[model samples]
Each structure stands twice: as C-alpha cells, then as structure tokens.
Target: MSYLSQITSPTLLIDEKICRANIKRMSDKAARHDMKLVPHWKTAQSHIIGDWAKEYGIKEVTASSIKMAEYLCGQGWDNIHIAFPFNTLEIPKLNELAKTQSLSVQVINPVTAQKLVDGLTEKVGFFIEIDAGYGRTGVHVSDFGLIEEILLTAKKSDKLYFKGFYLHAGHSYYMPDIPALYEQTRDALGMLKAKYQSEYPELVTRTGDTPGCAVMEDFGDIDEMGPGNFVFFDLMQANLGGCEKSEIAVALAVPVVDINRDRGEILVHGGGVHLAKDVLVDENGNKNFGEIVYLNEYGWTIPDHEDRSYLKSISQEHGIVKASKSLLNSVQIGDLLGVLPVHSCMTADCMGAYLSLDGKWIDHAEGCH
Candidate 1:
C-alpha cells in the first residue's frame, strides 16, 4: 500500500532519508570544526529517529527540560544535558535520573546553584548559562561579579561540578546578519572561557542556536554545538537562509476540506493545534503559518516558486492557504497536501508522533513513556 493509505487525520510526515542526510551534514560539519555535535532532542523527540543520530556517532544529547531528560534516559542515553535553566524544585527528580546517566543542567543564578548543592545526592555537572545578547535567560556576559558568585556558590558543594558555560544566542533566528551575531557571541564566550579555563582546566564552551550552528563554518571557541531545529528545517529556518526548503525533512499532511476559488484560497484540516502557533512574517509583511508542498511516491517536494502556496492564516483547527492560480488548480477536496511548518520543533511536539514515508509509525516524546 502507498503511504497515504495509512493517513486518516492530520499527520506529521518525516522523510527518513532526508532526515538522515541532514544529520550526516551536521555531523560532518561538527567533525570539520573540531566540535562535538550534542544535538537537542526538542525537535525530533523520537527514539527511533534518535537512533539515526547515533549512526552518526552522537552519543550525548541535549534536552529542553528535566522531563525531557528523563524520557531520554529511559531510551538508554548515557550522557544527557538539560539546556533549560535549572529548576531547583525538580531536584529530587533530577537526582533520581542522574544516578543512571551522566546528567548536566544549566544554572543562571547562585540561588539555584546552592539549591543543587544542598539537594543533589549524586554529583551532576553544571554549565553556567550566559546571556551573550539573547536576553531570554542566563547571566549577562559582562557581569563578572554575578558569574563569580554563581560559580563560587556551586563550588561550595562537592556534589556540584562546574562544566564551563552555555550560550543560546536566540536572536540569530530572526537577525538578518548571522555572521555579526555569531562573532559577538564568539567573542563574549571566548573571553569567558579564557578567563576561567585556568581555574577549570577541562572547561568547555557550548552554543545552542540552530541558525548560528547551521550556517557558520567557523566555531571560534565553541567546543559543542547543540542545535535541535536543523534536523527538520522549517519554514522559519528556510526564510532565515539556514537551510534550503528542500532540506526540510518533515511536513504536515493536511487533508483539503474546502476550495474557495472566489477568494483564491484553500482550506485544510491543520491549524494551531497541530502546527503550533509559531508564525513567520514574510518580506512582504504578511504572516505565514506554513508553506505548502506537494506529496509524491517517494516523499514531498517544494513547490515551484512561481506557483507557491502557503498557509496565510491558521485558527484552532483550520488553516487558510493563500494559493496561486496554479496552486489552486492543483488539488481538490479530500486530497492530502503537505505543509512545511513554521517551527519544526513546536510542530513536532504538537503532533506527538510521526508517519515516516516508509509507512512506519514513529513515536515521539509527547504521549510516550
């Protein structure tokens, strides 16, 4: 049977071949730059797909939360790092999970550091989170006093081991000049690593933004690259020039429900609930929920630029596709149309599981043990 015969609802379709290729590309990039590719599992949160990464020698993985770390540990990952700021309340859970695997957590404040020191039974490594310019979390790069305070607080307990610094530099996702953003981050991290490497001789630096990790060839002082979204490049990454549209490994297979030729639009059964609410504003100042692609026997292909169609608007369970004349004529009601998501990470989390092109059901983190 064809792959489409297994589809009944809006499903996330993963092209495993394309996904493996993207993995190999990133793995090769890490080898060339002499950095460890500790990919974040927040994107394709599937142990089945995670096996593909292991084929490329990625033994260590990054998780977005303690819960994610626990899930990864159950999958037999020996070394896992939780990239989110340390949540002291989850210390009991963290301690339990750390006993089975080499676990690391991100700490932005001394208070959390002390909590870890007081509560941690099993020794766990801590990365001082640095806010180079992202302003989301992490201590400011120039706040040497705060940095020292956090480090000193953590050092009070033998249970807490310092594991250098972590920076996400999230602005690279929207910033037009990635090289400039990366340079500023490199300098800030380089300075921090230089100042403290003598104290902690085994110190390492890690960067976690997909845009910077995907595009930049030169990783100055960064010892580890922890990007998640590059595994399934979304519409946002393609717009930001991180990857070509063809490299997007996952697409939403939404069944067409309506054809509105009068308004030159088509409607699908996919919306915020399945695609997430992440939207990208195009160069023409229009909001785009997802970009449309067509499915075939092998997988899917990006539509011709001259006849591009995209999900211009999305509600809770409905998607409105702004279609060109050629796009409008291409499909009918009840047909399955592929959509490249705005954010692959969020979309994958929302969809919960995947239907690979080879007709296998892949389990993801959502709703899994």
Candidate 2:
C-alpha cells in the first residue's frame, strides 16, 4: 500500500509546498543580508529536513542539546552549534563532540568558562554569549569587559578557540508588535555590538531569534543570523507578522471523536498528546487552543470558525472545539478534522512522525527521551 493510503486516523500532515517555500524564503532573506543562515534544527528534528535545508545552501546547523549535536554530527553534518548553555555534567560528551565534529558551544558565565578551560581539549570552539536584551542565558551586555577576560582565560590553553559573541533576542517574542520588536532588537544589538567593537574590534556578532531575524531589515552590525523557527512558520510567527497563513507548513490531522449539539462542542482524538496546550488569548483572557481550518468528507464545517479563531480546550487525549449550533450538530464520529496548531515547534515535538498532505508517511523528528 502507498504511504498516504496507510495513514490511520489522527495523522500529522505537513504541506510539502509550504515547507519548501518557508525554507526558500528564509534562505533568500539570509542571502540578501550577506549573512550565513544557520537554521536551528531543533525545530524540525529530522535529518531529512536538515538535508532539505542543506539543499537550500544552509551548511551550518544549530541544536538545543549536546545529544542533538552528536546525532547531527554523526549524520554527516560538520558545523554544529549547541545553542544551549554549557552544562558541566555533559563536559565529557561535549569534549567528544568537539573532538570529532566541528563543534561550537555557547557559554554565558565565568564559572562555566573556567571549567571548560580547565578541561580544555583542542576540539571545541566557544562563543561568548552576551545577553543583549533577553533576560535569558548569556553574559550581560553591560559586562563587555568580561569578553576579553573570557578570551584571555581561554587562551591559557591552546586547546580552546574563542570564536566570537552570540546573542538571542528572545524577549522580542514577548513584544505586542513586530515593529516594536524590530526597534528593540535593532537598538539592543546595536548598542551591544558598539560596546564589543570598542573593546574587541575583530570579534564577530551572532544573533538568532526568528522574530528579530525575520522582520528586521538592518543587518549592518550582525555577522550571522541564527534563526531556526523561520524554517517552519507557526501561527505565533504569523501573529508576529513573520510569515503569512500560506506560509504555515505544519498541521494536526485530528479525528472527530464526539459531538454535542446542545453545547456546540466537538471532541477530537487529538489532545495535548498531539496538539499541545499552546494558546493565545484576548484582553478578557479567553483562551484558544488552536484554529479549525477544514474538514474531510463530512461537510462538518465549524460555523463562525475561521483561521483566526482558537481550538479552545484540550485534555490529555481529547481536544474540545467551541463551535456554533449548526456546525456542532453535523459532526460525526471518525470524521477527519484539520486543525492549525498555534505553535508548530510544540506540536511537532509531540508528534513522532509526519503524514504528508500528499499521502506520504515520512519519518520525521528525533526521539528525545
């Protein structure tokens, strides 16, 4: 039987056209800026997808963990950046990765820096993570003086190579509008880079965050863009004006489990196990699980439901839809419901594989324990 013909109920369908388009657009954006696009593979954890990126001229890749770094390295990917902080516990494994693969690790503190230098091996490269505007990991931008200290400290051993500086404007994702995020990211990186250039004229500036990299036009100070989410545009990205609805590549194909006409609700087999609890609410704080886009074979339309609405509620194994009376009355058991996830990363992480819209069962995602 063909892969699509074998797709059981409640499959994970990805639109191939949209996925390719997203990759092309981000690659084009990085090219226009004269910057290298090292997309975070943590978003789409499949080597198959990584191969797709490689075909688009993306040579370098980023991951969230040392394990992912090792896996990607073994799969013939040479340049790998572990975007997370340096964990002392994984020092041995990290050392091995560095020795075997072209590895770059992100470190934000003097303590980790000291540990790494003490355990110095010739394989690893380090990026001084400066907390530009994000309150997350990375040394404070105000601590520009420490960059030289970290470099000098690492230089104690010939084993370490301090490549440059890296930052993630994660705070940009919290902004209400993309323009506000763009201004905040631009100014923050600008000030941070100026301080760095004053101290270390030859240092490179690496910034990665989908919101900032996708919307900002000024790449004057940045040496490279490290956006991973741009490869798979989600509803959150859409809301942030990063991409259009046509650009969204992933979706959850849920099975209709129950219908309640009196209450105007439809239950689907897809729950937190498939769709996750990602939602966006209004000023009144009303939550939406996701949006119901289309139905299969049953004219079981969700009345008054459009791509802009939300999925409302989800239990461990069930998704609740808040629909109008007429639409709820038509839902039947076993009907296929096409739901757009609010966040593609969270949703894809829950699913173990992807069932293509063209009816191909593609093995995607890394089995993270």
Candidate 3:
C-alpha cells in the first residue's frame, strides 16, 4: 500500500514541501529587491497556503476580485489589494471592507474613478493601472496626463488616497526564452516609471505575473511586486523559461482508464474539467496540453522522468498520450498517471481540493476567483 494507492482517481495532488519552498522563493525575491511582497491569493486559493505565506513575512496580499478580498477578510487578514480593475457592481462590498480594514482597488479609467468617488463611503487606496504593453486593461503608458487628471479628480473627494501605479506584463508569460522575459519586464516597467519625479518619488510602481518577477533580476523602479503562479510553477512557466521542471510543485494524479494501443494513446479519467484547456504550442507549432509522469509505490513519484517521457495532448476530459505504440501497450486501465498542467492557475481552479503526496487532505479554502 502506497500513498498513490490510497488516493482516489482524478485527485489534485500537491507536493507539500515543494509548495512551501515555492512560497519562500517568491517572498525572498521581493525582500532582496527591497519591494513590498504582496503575494497574490489568486494562485493557490487555499487558506493553509496563505498562512504559509504569512509566516514568510507576507503582510500584504493581492487578489484578482472583490470576492477574494472578502474571503481573505473572513480569515482575519486585512491589508489587501484587489488587483483587477474595479468592478462597479462590487462597490457595496468594497465600501463594507474599507470600513474595517485597509483596501486598495485598481482603477483602469476615469469613469471607474468617478464611480469610486460617488459610491465609496470610506477612504480607500487606489492604484492607477497603466497598460504598459500588455494591452489588457490599464490606461496607455503614453497617457500619464490622463492618470494625473483622474488622480486630481479623486483628490477633490478625499475619499481615495493615491497609492501608486500597477502594471502586469502578462505578455511576458508567452515568451519563448528567459532573456525575452527579462527584457519585457525591464522595458515595460522602465517606460511606465520613467517620469516618477514627485516628492513622494516612491510612488509604488509595481508589476505582478510570476514569469517576470521570478526570472528577471532587472525590473527597474518597482516599489512592490506581486508574483502568484510561482507558488505552483506549471509546465507553461518551465517551457517559457520561468523555472526548471523541478520547480513545479503541483500535478494532477489521473488514473489511466483505457489504453488505445491501436491509436497509440492512453486515456486518463482526468479531463478539461480537472485540468482546464490550457495547452502550450511550441515555436514549431507542436501543442502540449499537459506533461505526464509515472507515480510509483512511493508518494506521487516522478520516477526520474524527463520532460517528454509521457503523454502530452488533452481533450475536455480525455488526455491523449504521446507515447510510443509499445509504451502505450504497457499502460494498464487502473494505473495512475501523474500529469503536470500547462497552467496551474486554471488547473487548480478546476480542482476544488488537493490530495497531498503524503496521503493528507488539504482543502482549497479560497472561494472562486
């Protein structure tokens, strides 16, 4: 009887020790750079993991939605920043949270700022978003005047305190190499903070996205850092040069339900419902949905496997193996196949809870993002 033997099929397994190490690594990175380490709770939404981050001196946390801020507030940690552009519908909850604790919300436009001024009953910190090449939400980096105008308008109300600017170089996650990622981080932050000449020159220029914060050492003029995915570095991170394969802390343990030897495929019980549809295509257009590893008699084992040792392609619920015809024949119906997800964030969201490699159960405490 082994750790894998006791677990059920399609269970989300997290290597506890590795998960701890991953949190420390990101916290250490922020400490060394002399920036505030606002660990984003959007990645591993487990309260247990959040406590681990707090033990590592993570006083501030960032979240992707107002609901997450509520979830964290329920757990008694107050200093939080809802990193996404403010959702107008959540104003009532935002007002409620601000009364009890410190809350900073992101605003991408003047319309949102005006709304904040109108409905915000209590004072709140605001981080003006800058679209520094990601093209997601923020105001364009060239339009600093627009940011100044919004700040000025908010100033008249006295209900909002200007925290600083925030930009997420999310496009950097698509890079094919580390050098490209590092350059993207440096260039994006450099252009955004090129004119920080106010008396409070420390205007909290920040960027989130784990690839830039984890791989690059030259993110210029960043006052605060938010790197969430490094807590469970996925295959996409490794493939994109954020970290090595060894840094991946979580993997899905899917049981092989069938073996299609005629077509050279191994069908696993885990589907897109468990792993999500996050596939990564290489430069030559080779698509890899997930990485497969062998889990042996010991805990969730990797068996000293290399990158391409197991299967790769995935469907909504069925994972298609890339193994040789002979290897496919060796797989049994009840065999458990350890799968590394292409994107940990999506995969973990699909999985409601986790089964530790050591046969312990750790419930995912955070609510849906």
The numbered model that scores best in lDDT is: 1
| Weakest ten-residue segment in model 3 by summed lDDT | 298-307
Candidate 2: RMSD to truth: 3.1
Model 2 Cα displacement at 135 (Å)? Answer: 1.0
Which candidate leads the pack in TM-score? Answer: 1
User: Once superposed on the true structure, which residue ranges of model 3 sit more than 4 Å away at CA?
Assistant: 176-202, 303-312, 324-330, 365-367
All models: lDDT? 0.90, 0.74, 0.78
lDDT of 2 by residue, 139-241 (tens): 8767756766777777776676766778788877787565665565556567766765765666666778887787888776677888887777787887778
Better of 2 and 3 by lDDT: 3
Error of 1 at 173 (Å): 1.3
TM values, all candidates:
0.97, 0.89, 0.90
lDDT of 1 by residue, 87-168 (tens): 8989999889888889999999988998998999998998999998889898999999999998899878988899989999
Measured with C-alpha atoms, the lDDT of residue 67 in candidate 3 is 76
Give candidate 1's whole-model lDDT. Answer: 0.90
